[model samples]
Target: MPVDNHDHDHQDRFEERLGEALHQAGGAYETDRRALVAAGETRGHRLLLRRRAAVVAGVASVALVGLGGALLVPGGDDGRQSVATGAKTPVASATPKASYTGDELIGILEKLLPRGEFSSPQARGTDDRLPPYAQVVHDDGKGKAAVAVGFDRVLPGSEQARQTVECPDKVLTPYDGCVVSRLSDGSALRIFQGYEYPDRRADTKLWTADLVTPKGQHVSVSEWNAAAEKGAPVSRAEPPLSPARLRTLATAAAWLGVVDAIPVDPKAPTAAPAQPSGIDGGAIASTLVSLLPKGVKVVARSGPDSGYAYVVVDDGKGRSLVQINVQPNMSDVEDQLFGAGAETLADGTKVVTHKEPGEKGGAGVVMWTADTLRTDGFRVVVSAFNSGSQETAATRDAPALTTKQLRAIALSAKWRGLG
Candidate 1:
């Protein structure tokens, strides 16, 4: 099936960073046809695993990472080339023809899997409208599992590439085990054992091996205990493939030829724009701490460089998590984020309060949010959770701060200094 764009866009920072890195590395895929198969596999794999993890913990910190703007390029037809917007030159001449079809690539994947009975096979050819991918339900005598493999690229020496191989902070992302290592061939590789949901509310497990060659060839292999990534029950204790097997699949030579067949978009490198300037996380956290109500004791704080900050506080009762995001020039999204129910103050500041369930679906965990926007396009949104992390159990019956207090803090004059 074609990848879901919605799900892809909402992936956690780790996956998104990897995607950006791959795009940068594969800028020359089209012109270099000597290794077409590898290119195709690389591109398809990147797209397929776009949202492999969206609800992971510590995503707030990850969002603070800076990235450049990106220019999206639509897939082109067989005989045509899609030129990137703002290109100063014409599209380059046709490169070598792709040697392998999508099915041929899938055939290569099937051959690489360990001895097993494969069923529910679905494969996309290299020439297909959507990025190509191969998926199957493999039974290795123990249980049936979903396994998939695809290809992508990353720019060597780019910030995106450097961040791609970095391990997620354990405090922000709770994982069973994660390893980053350099292969003998000098390729950077990461193996992660993590749950599909950061909260581990379900039994679904996702394991992946991400590899990027020095030349920017990217290959990712993923497996799950369920038949599908979501809406499926866990079929076994773990995925069918082991970390060793996943590494073997990702580093296979067969994929290199296929990756060369994948077309490259001239705009891939230009897609990411620079990060927006705003208040530093430390300042935001300090400001919030100073504005807290008396008798509330802060136990911990997070967000140093990010524009968002959070603190764990106790109010002679239980612990609560309070977080805030400070953004500038956000008038463009004012209407969408704040509706007609929002109130306007004498100072022309619009404010809205929301009481909703925790984003991670933790049982009995509630969230209270106060959103405020000044006429000058300054936005301050503060939220409090009954729990320290959305992935964990509720530590308090309610957030330490009331909605009124949250509203007051969000609209404080102290925030104007950040401007």
Candidate 2:
């Protein structure tokens, strides 16, 4: 996989500490419900949550993985229950876990990313240039599994600390499985394996773990780390992680301490004057889609804002919309765009989301709101939404648009019946 060493280095630092988390989980509730494992058999670190929250389908869900696909799903609301303070406890069992084949770890990994295949770790003698951050290891037994993931040369720090400013543009281009790009959160993940990388090596296992241990089975991360130390030159490949598991990784402060930050309210209603309107929904959706930057698409749209664009689409599944907006203004649309820390553009475009009032967790459309006076007399409002991912509520925002430009886009979108 073509991962940035900078990202790898950063992940390395964090993973090193990941070992200590084991002792924390060892103290309590070991007899509580066991980890949702794959049938039976296990190895490596046992994953149990004293309090693990599942991603609510509506508010926040898992997202597409791979290179380029690894972009941050804008900070938004999580419908899950509020978090409880505490680390997960290991499974309770007076008996020490008997060493088993490495299948148990493999199974946990398989669930974490079911789309993946199995393969041996990289052999030290291979002609392939191994990633310096490539450290793939697992325990033979002890029941439980945790893949010690790593990235090469990539910024190794908190997701918030590293913004997208460090990545290159072509990183997102095709022809390569992984394209490095900045995300709203600041951290950049190289989509390796088929997720995003050079070889797309739909051909390497790169990911490994032990078999699933029986439900009562569990192990600590520190214990697993010590055991994995005995293994060397583990495979280095981009492993496919389950969207759900990936969500846990992204939101878990322990792994990355990733917190969910969303602009519940708008940036405060802008002082900009309202423009004309009349462009219907169809016209608005068509024009907005046409005007969007490449690689951007529309997932959802609304009617025109009284006289401005009124819809936002994180992943443009189809067209755009124009509608009434009731959310507060976003702090800075452009800053949120182009990933975090993005400076204002020369055009002075304002990106905003049309959120439901009093709503929280970034649930709304994000687009450029605009109003234009059409020749027909019906004024129209339009919003171009084509940022973020489908899994995030940030898609509903629409801002930085004007009536005039919206009308132009609407004009182009006007349906002319074929003769």
Candidate 3:
């Protein structure tokens, strides 16, 4: 979404002040400009990624977070760290998601292949504008498989988004830039890549290799380069298990939990106003603020774009932290998608990312960009972490959080309340 100055004096003032505040922050100017360049270059990246050239990583918000399924996490390098307990996730033997049907998958194939051929097309690397032949193959790791036959002027991502809309029976998860189907059989198939932000000129062919635990959770190894030529199809080694942990993977991606966790937008009017959760939006912000260094004075705000009343508390010093987001009881997948990080791992997934050098910050840092979703009646919680400690702190806490923590943060967090 692009920001426009609509001549609202209040908005203009806020923008003016915000800009001045950013300038005072110094490095934030660079961060903001770099973020802008990354955002604008999205479409251009897809245009240039087809040369099979080596790609480089750059700045991006919400880059993939890895839920590493390591066989044995080293404990303090002394070979004795007790691994942290597994985070709870949903699991069940999926028959294949009922949301999509076989016919829909075939339709997607028609667009990818030439006459939707079963075998590789006669032309190799020629500019004939070939269509890919899609198939629901086996052995693709997440329990099912899918393959696209060719790429003669075919950009996987542009096509993947189109296919997702038509194929409702499947779970469409985007990895790196390519897309994949989270099949009911507990497998994922690579489709194509989408546009990556920050530097479209950096690279294109996003690749993903998927693995689904017997318990049904998935893990993908995604790379944004020539996915096929430079890598193995899917390489994996089983992780030692806890039977209980395995059972959790079979369930859905916990979209329901995420829905249950979002706090209602304070700005949305009740027509029939939605029921208020026990906790209000302020708690989210307050909780967010509370998590920071003591004595850090913060200016707070509440908004609806994020599907959760979000609180961004900025310490008067150049550093900041996004503390809380509260959502009311709602049962929509779209909100869940927008509101929370992935609760379960999926196939064809990768953990690729980009960040500023010397900055070391990574995914999940709240930003002003999440604000635009509000116009559509969404709620957003935006937070900026203080420099240095920001990324180190968030990544460490992300996977350790339980469903209980997620819900409590939304339902019980207290904020500086004026909604």
Candidate 4:
């Protein structure tokens, strides 16, 4: 329901670093577009699968890798692209596009920033496999902080573009302040002030300015109160850049040139994917609320996120977080999920119940779950937490809903009709 940062397993860390390194490699190199596009699409598919695992399995650390996209950075002193991973060598492209090296982009960022000491600079050029970005630890005579800028493209007037600037729901992403404005040139800009950890488990602050132009150019500027985004103590009261400065930096005209240099992925879907369709998030949320037993009222809820929904309800005792995920064509994994101890209904639906410690690392927190898979390969799982948020300490001894209630909710006829 919400995002949190915690220690990840060794494999998770390896994958995260690999993804970051691959994205940060940049240079003026060329390769067969067809092959690269195929690889990128393959990566995109894997990314989606990982995201689903994060949501369903509560592997919060895996979700921190990043939103799927390439990262572009600056070149070296000799103006040659720097490779972070040294995994791929670019041959030659039959068609070459005008682009900026990582060094050039970093130079622009240095010139745009206020007088300050910069260190730990990292970049990827426009011609890199991933989109370009420039990052550095900047000290503006105050405390050290990390500042970064990145470029990408979105379909104009599409849901992606709109969501790029839309403020997240407070229930899902607790933040200090968020502002969305339209620039005179018809671009959308969002200035967000939030914590690096949504639950305020840590004091690190993250502020960002996201801009999307009418023609689909996207520029994002982000800064942190600490020298690094994670695992660093707070270095200052706030990030080095103010909201106005962040807006100015992200909207800089120089970034537009960088964005224009990025080539459109030939294999990228022009429209949304066709599969995995069912009830909308709004319908799911409405259905969840309706299923709640008496004496409980919804105190907070999530936006319609399609196939997943959550609500925090308060009984006279305390607040609890309940969430559900509905999936179609899940029979392939049914054997792994529904084991020998699982109960089988007369109609052939498999049901399993689990009582376990919360995966989010909240002290004293517990999770009660009800998992079910229909004969048609449709799966519905319902879980309830003893705390209002999985990241916080438990407020009560148990979740407001009993395991039986969760099972009933998961097996409800209402869910079958929706799917």
Estimated TM-score for each candidate: 0.71, 0.23, 0.23, 0.74
The model with the greater lDDT, 1 or 3, is 1
Could you say which candidate leads in TM-score? 4
Q: Write the per-residue lDDT of candidate 1 for residues 1-419, one digit (tens) a residue.
A: 33323134212222333354333433212322111111111222221011212322122222212212222222321121222222111111144346667667667778988888887676655554334566787888888888876655666555445445444543345567655556544556666677777777888888877666666666667788887767678989999888767767776776665555666766666433344454787998999999999999998776464556678899988888787777777676666666778899998999988887765566788888888889988888888888866567787889999999999999999998976
Deviation in angstroms for 262 in model 1? 1.6
Best by lDDT: 4
Winner on TM-score between 1 and 2 is 1
lDDT of 3: 0.26
Give candidate 2 misplaced runs (Cα > 4 Å): 1-419
* Reference-based TM-score, model 4: 0.74
Q: 16-95 in candidate 2: lDDT tens per residue?
A: 32222212323221321112110000112222111111100011122223212343333222221211112122222233
Model 3 segments more than 4 A misplaced: 1-225, 228-302, 305-309, 312-318, 325-419
List the lowest-lDDT window of 10 residues for candidate 2.
Answer: 50-59
Better of 3 and 4 by lDDT: 4
How many residue pairs clash in all the candidates, one count each? 41, 102, 58, 18
lDDT of each: 0.62, 0.26, 0.26, 0.65
Better of 1 and 4 by TM-score: 4
Error of 1 at 359 (Å): 2.9
